[model samples]
Target chain A: MKPLPRIVSVLSAALIIAAAIGFLDAAYLAAKYFTGGPIACSVLDGCDTVTKSAYAVPAGIPVAVLGVMFYASVLVLALVFRERRSVTIARLLAIAGAIGFLASVWLVSVQVFILDALCLYCILSAGSSTAIFILGIAVWRLAVARANASDAAGHDSTAGRLPAVGNK
Target chain B: MSKSSIAILGVVVLAAAGLVYLGIAADGGPAAGGQAAIMTAEDHVKGNREAMVVLVEYSDFQCPACAAYYPLVKKIAEDYANDVAIVYRHFPLQQHRQAVAAAQAAEAAANQGRFWEMHDMLFEHQGEWSGNANAAELFAGYAAAIGLDGDQYRRDVEASAGRDRAQEDFQSGRAAGVNATPTFFLNGQRIVGPQSYSEFAALLDEAIAQNR
Candidate 1:
């Protein structure tokens, strides 16, 4: 019911969206490997270039495998939270999501600028992560509000009155 | 905000999440779209067990490119023998005069379960058999050199069955988008031109990891 909780819920939804993108990328890779068909990549020779590139696989596993892990982790971070710790947890999740989003963006840049190709799924994953990061920042602001409210309410004796960025 | 407000937010978030999932699952996505042509030599593969990797080669015995690639392909085949299945498909170009005939001879040997042996012999004496002058004599000698039933080989070479098989292989290569000699398909993905052993090994490693 609190503002912080509402913001956390929104971020959780965004995290799920990113995870969905990751799942789709993984599924497409699976289908291409087994069926021997043209992988409909978004960019020119996207499928061929990306799949054939040495960077496509890391540690003997497809890069999509790692995308799925990162997205799922973000989703879990968003979904699991106690109202008492909602503010702190949401902030932590947002910071992590931003880091992940930047990483994805870097990868997409490499794919396009260096590889001279675009992988649709990679684009989607990067775009979704960026969205989640923005949503996460909003959640972090709400957490700052919650912390400020708790301090003002005399609920936490050890805390000082913090800056009021927004109503909790 | 009340408990009802919280409940409404939860419902919206969950619904949006479901929609996101549906959007992603709507199509098979980018990775499963292109269809690479499968080579016909895939049929001659009598080995029951599925190989870890199939090296489908489009080769012309008399073509210089084919001759150049011969050693690399041989090295790859030997290095990855049990793990990789090598399917040689004839891709005799019109420029190469005796390539079709050489391919026919190889096919005839294949019928007698000596396809690979005859294949090696053809590559070994590419210069002598590649010319029109002594092709038959050189081919017959190769048949004898490989300990084939020389008389039957001569008959089979003249039968047109061997020639037909070679034509079929050439057609298959064309269908698979082979424009030049020594085009290779490693597990159905075309790996163009002659590359180092390490390159082939690396690609094969990726294919095996994918299979696992």
Candidate 2:
């Protein structure tokens, strides 16, 4: 029932900011896809090759759409944890972050190895996704620490009492 | 999730949905709003010159990306010979010191019924004369190889006769919203440049089908 650690609140705020950036970057690309208008590739080097490639829109859905979904969930998850301070919420964020981090790794590899080109906007979204993963872990760790501290306090106060079994 | 958590999530979801809607609406989706002038008898066209599905490219010869796109465009011209009319216009950028000169060379070659040949040679060997100070001489060599009157080609280059034509294409390209090399407009609507032959073919096929 006690309030979660201050660090959790701080990290949740960080997650929200990171996720918002990722969301915006992804949203812009999705909009570009919907518009399907003139795409000017750089004269000598850059994004048009990557974006216009087949890999960019797998199954007719822009990869940015997937990014939007991931980041929006992160943004909402972080916001919820900030207000509710629920351990379940913290765990969810940590899981989401881990998934996002792995996905970014794969996305970057595609840009470098398979596509052999880097898109500035795609890189920006990747950075934000990585940030969300890190911040999520920080909040989840703090929540676990707080729960452990409270349990320790309870044990010291009630020396003869048996702890409840199952589900820690 | 608690009531407050659910409420916050719902609010954020609604906000994201609203943002996406605005993004799409603001972009106005794809519409046929090409400012590039329609190709006519004066324009340099290849393939079915009278076809309804015309693919016009505003391109710079010295640009590496345009060079990269050269082969792809060549393939498209061949594959869609019956359905698409391929038009190439000069969009020589100022930054590439020799872009205007290269465009001029093509124009000179055009006077001899060899513009596309010069266009192909320039792009195929872009790396050779890209920044060469003797670019005009290199172009003259191309003029000879393509079997043009070498003497007249030299005179055309020296007099800047081809420059006037390059300038017209440049002006029209600017009007058409071409700010980069290799900008393609299919049926007066801009379409993303394809990365490969199949991608371009697919686009051409779609356009051809629509034209019918």
Candidate 1 Cα outliers beyond 4 Å, as residue runs: A1-168, B1-49
Clashes of 2: 0
Q: Which ten-residue region of model 1 chain A has the weakest summed lDDT?
A: A37-46
Tell me how far the alpha carbon of residue A49 in candidate 2 is from the true structure, in angstroms, after superposition. Answer: 4.8
Tens digits of lDDT, candidate 1, B1-212: 33543564465446545644554454332121012224343344422236766667667776544565677767877776667777777777665567788888887787677887888898877755665578978888888888889878888888888778778777766666555556667777776322566876887777777876
Model 1 agreement with the true structure over A71-161: per-residue lDDT tens digits: 6566555554322335666677788778878878777877755654455566777787787788777766766776778776766552532
User: By lDDT, who's the top model here?
Assistant: 2
Which pairs in model 1 have colliding backbones?
A37-B34, A38-B33, A38-B34, A38-B35, A39-B33, A39-B34
What fraction of the genuine interface contacts, i.e. the true contacts, does candidate 1 reproduce? 0.00
lDDT, candidate 2, B1-212, per-residue tens: 55755675566666666877875665342335255638868789999987989888888886666777888889888877888899988887665678888888888888888889999999898777876778877888888888999888877776666788889888887777666677788888877646678878898889888879
What's each prediction's TM-score?
A: 0.45, 0.56
DockQ of 2: 0.18
CA lDDT of every candidate: 0.62, 0.75
